[model samples]
Target: MASKGKISIIGSGLIGRNWAMLFASVGYNISLFDIDESRIDDALVDIKQQLNSLESKNLLRGSLNAEQQFSLIDKCISMEECLRNSIYCQECVFEKLELKVQVFQQIDKYVDDKTVLASSTSCLLPSSFSANLNHKSQVIVAHPVNPAYYIPLVELVPAPWTDEKVVARTRELMTEIGQKSVTLKKEIEGFLVNRVQYSILNECYRLIAGDYVSVEDIDSVMCDGLGLRYAFMGPWETAHLNANGMKEYFEKYSKGIYDVSKTFGEIPKMEGATADHIANELTSRIPLEKLNERRKWREERLIAITQLKKTLDKH
Candidate 1:
């Protein structure tokens, strides 16, 4: 496919490689840059293999074929070259606050006013890193799920000083590339997804700690019970569909829900015997050696569900 414009992806790790492929599949020229030379080389190889695999399975995204998408990615030797003339750049570096600050400092120096400086951060607030940058107005957070190719939801967040136009442009770019994007009204720690995720984890931990449920049962509670309904609709929509509507549903279940929530009590520390027991159970089922295989298995299921949802929506 012909290029639309240039996008630079810093730190060519897993997230970076997925971002590169997603952008390239939609005809964007991608500069995949990493400070470590070998890492960049390895990313390129993995990206090629992934794209080719997707193509062979007829699951490749956008209008571009595997070879075309692979051709669009350029490995950069220097930050200067990667930042030059790019319309947007996503920093996919390590999640440490100090490391992000330093990387953004470097990116801020290189990028021009027109370029959008977005971070792929999961937990850190944008104000923490972009506050000291010269181009703070252009800085925003566009956090994607681990595998950007299948999981399309991206949380778009802007620092207080970030330009409104930058946020809009980031959303536009994400949509154009076929990713679902939502913008947070204001900044907060852990963003949207992680906050929801951690809430679930906390409860799960509490249950296990209290001896009310096993780790595997908690997993089944999600995968077999809640996960089935949540796959297509959110809790609110599911409530709407399950009952008459919001008002009637809330009237019927609010008291029961509130009562159950009150029973949750204090949060567990998630340490000591409970943590060790949970770890052992998980590791026994998914050993360290097969973790990667399990992760890949999970990603394949995500892709399948994504495809299923798309097909159903069309009908």
Candidate 2:
């Protein structure tokens, strides 16, 4: 399904490199550009290693070998070259606002009017960077998480001035390239996923600081209990299924939920003993020395999970 147009990735950092692999593995021609050529140089090596890693895990598509898979990436010396025949460009540079503004300005000049310019920013909104560009209507945020080669959720956030058709096209392109995209009806801070995550994190922190639960118990509560159900069903879906349906579920639990919510207060500022406790607890489990190795393990596990999901979908 990835027989779409070329994908040009700007910035050769972790996000850009992963985007290159994701677009390439699914059969899109990938072009990468960076001011620091060494970053691109290093990225090619990392991508090759990643491809081999996926192949070792039996996760690569189209029965392609590592060498054949690596052939889809083209490292362009300049932005113009990368944008020459591209239909979409994903900018994954630093998260700074001014840097994104400058990068988008240059990319706007090179790509045609129809080409979509998507930002990989985690926080900065599209309107923050793309507002000054001539092709602002064609620009939007296509934020993907780290290790995008494995995790495919992309948030497609559009600015107020962004064209609706452009958003539709971006969503279509993401789908064709094997990405799962969720559209935001209107722009909001942090979009959907992070806001939900932060809200949970805030509650967890409050509970721990209030001495209601131990740090280890808090982590285990999700990993052992909630995470299992969350893996297959969302919160609302689980709630509905727990009862007869959505209406019945709400009818029985609305007052209980209201009372529980009333007891919950705003999260405390995490700057003192609470933060230190979390740091000590997490570090004891995952030491700073093994951080890089642990990250690789997490990526490998995500790859396996993604492969399992693909197999399940086939059935």
lDDT for each residue of candidate 2 in 1-315, tens digit (9 for 90 to 100): 355568899999989988887777667788989988888999998889878877887777555577776888888888899998788899999989899999999998998888888999888888888888899999989988677777788999999889998899999987866888999987898988889888889989999888899889998999899988887778999998999999999999999999998887986798899999999999999999999999989887887787787789899
TM-score of model 1 relative to the true fold?
0.96
Query: How far does residue 34 in candidate 2 sit from its true spot (Å)?
Result: 0.5
Overall lDDT per candidate, in order of appearance = 0.92, 0.86
Q: Give the best candidate by TM-score.
A: 1
The true-versus-predicted C-alpha distance at residue 82 of model 2, in Å, is 1.6
After superposing candidate 2 on the true structure, give the runs of residues whose Cα lies further than 4 Å from its correct spot.
Answer: 1-4
**Candidate 1 per-residue lDDT over residues 88-168, each given as its tens digit:** 999999989999999999998888999999999998999999888889999999999878888899999999999999999
lDDT of 2: 0.86
Model 2 clashing-pair count:
0
lDDT (C-alpha) at residue 16 in model 2 = 91
TM-score, one value per model: 0.96, 0.94
